[model samples]
Target chain A: MAEQVTRKPYVREVPRMLWFLRHPRYMRYMAREFSCLFIGAYTLMLVVGLKRLAEGPDAWAGFLAALGSPGAIVFHLFALAFSAYHSITWFRLTPKAMPVQIGDTFVADRVISGAHYAGWALVSLVVLWLAGAF
Target chain B: MATSNKPIVWGPFAAGGTLTAFLTPVLILLTLLAGLGHAPDLLAYDALRAFAAHGIVKLGLVVVIFLSLWSAAHRLRITCYDLGLRADTLVATLVYAVAIAGTVAAAAYLLRLNPV
Candidate 1:
């Protein structure tokens, strides 16, 4: 049997909470991840709205009235900003996750992300149309 | 070694993230419009109620909410880990539980909404 050897590896302790603060890219990444909080809360608000709608006209009206408050408007403004940031970053990252190949050639990144932008525009138009924005 | 169940959560996170990227900004804008008393006619209370009363629309809305909640929950879980929370299992459980509760609540409400 060979003699047993012991080895110690040097490990640098990173300050977990403040590590991201060391780099601008990390800060941006954290912002992108943080957008989910606003997105999730906005969805929950929609769920609450659905509940109010289920409760009848009076309840639905009350819900809308509540949304008219200055605080709610500010909240929505912030949510929209964060959500738009999330969308931009998400689109930017999509080509890496999904690479399309045809005849031994992969699709260009701009083409892939541009397609997403086009789809986003089309969907927005449809939603606006459905909401009677036309 | 045990097989990781990461994909189960990852699947919804990806799908929901895509959906939100495409649609969430617009949805939030709609609410902002409503708050400003400029809601489109189709989004007005009665019209919205009628729209929700449709079976297909109800199903679609529930799916959207479910995916959105799950995506946010999973991302939040990762964020907590990054922030040094370290208690990943507990964080995962809490966030996923909230997501599930939101989904169930949305479904229940949509099911009860009747067309006038």
Candidate 2:
């Protein structure tokens, strides 16, 4: 029989709500991470719209009309704001995730972030142009 | 197993996160503004449908949707873990399944478009 060793381990039980409030960084991280939920919702909406488009004109038009509702408008507004937060925070984090080296010197974080913004603008313009909305 | 490889999911999650970083805001703004009936001439249903009829455009849409959804799923899985949902494997599986399902549905629909 193996001898039993008795030991008590101390465990910390943290209250899940307001867990980030104790630290500013945790709060920001949580805010940025949670914004993905809004992004996901918007993506799901686009998928539905795409399916409706495939279903032909009436379904597509119905989706458009549904988007005009007060509730949808409100949700969309919130989604837009959250997505902005998500984009900005993610852009800020990109440099840390994938650092760019220019020659022997490391690229500045701001430069990397700036390039991301520039690319974003150019892509947005292209998408707009392709859709003939520009 | 706690030692299970996470990089498989992480790679897509990171890529998806990056993709959404660039595109989500633009999509939301355009969609909501169009929703409010301010859709520009180029964005009218027929025009947008026409745009989707291209193979390259359809492929691009699939890539964007897949990455964004997968990233969101990864985020949700982390959120669940943080919230004390101790069953990491189950939560991860469930969330990832949702992302996969959404991506498959989106791809199927995009493929069904009239590639003009």
Candidate 2 wrongly placed segments (more than 4 Å): A1-13, B1-3
lDDT value, residue B5 of candidate 2: 68
Docking class of 1: medium
**Which residue pairs show collisions in model 1?**
none
Every model's TM-score: 0.93, 0.88
Note the residue pairs that clash in candidate 2: none
How close is chain B to the truth by TM-score, in each candidate?
A: 0.95, 0.90
Tens digits of per-residue lDDT for model 1, A1-134: 59766787889989979889888999999999999999999999999999998998899889888888999999999999999999989998999999899998999999999999899989988998889866
Candidate 2 interface CA RMSD, Å: 1.7
Q: Report the lDDT tens digits of candidate 2 across residue range B15-111.
A: 9888887788777777777778886565567877888889998889888988999899999889888866779889888988888888899889988
* DockQ of each candidate, alpha-carbon based: 0.79, 0.64
Ten-residue segment with the worst summed lDDT in candidate 2 chain A? A125-134
Which candidate tops DockQ?
Answer: 1
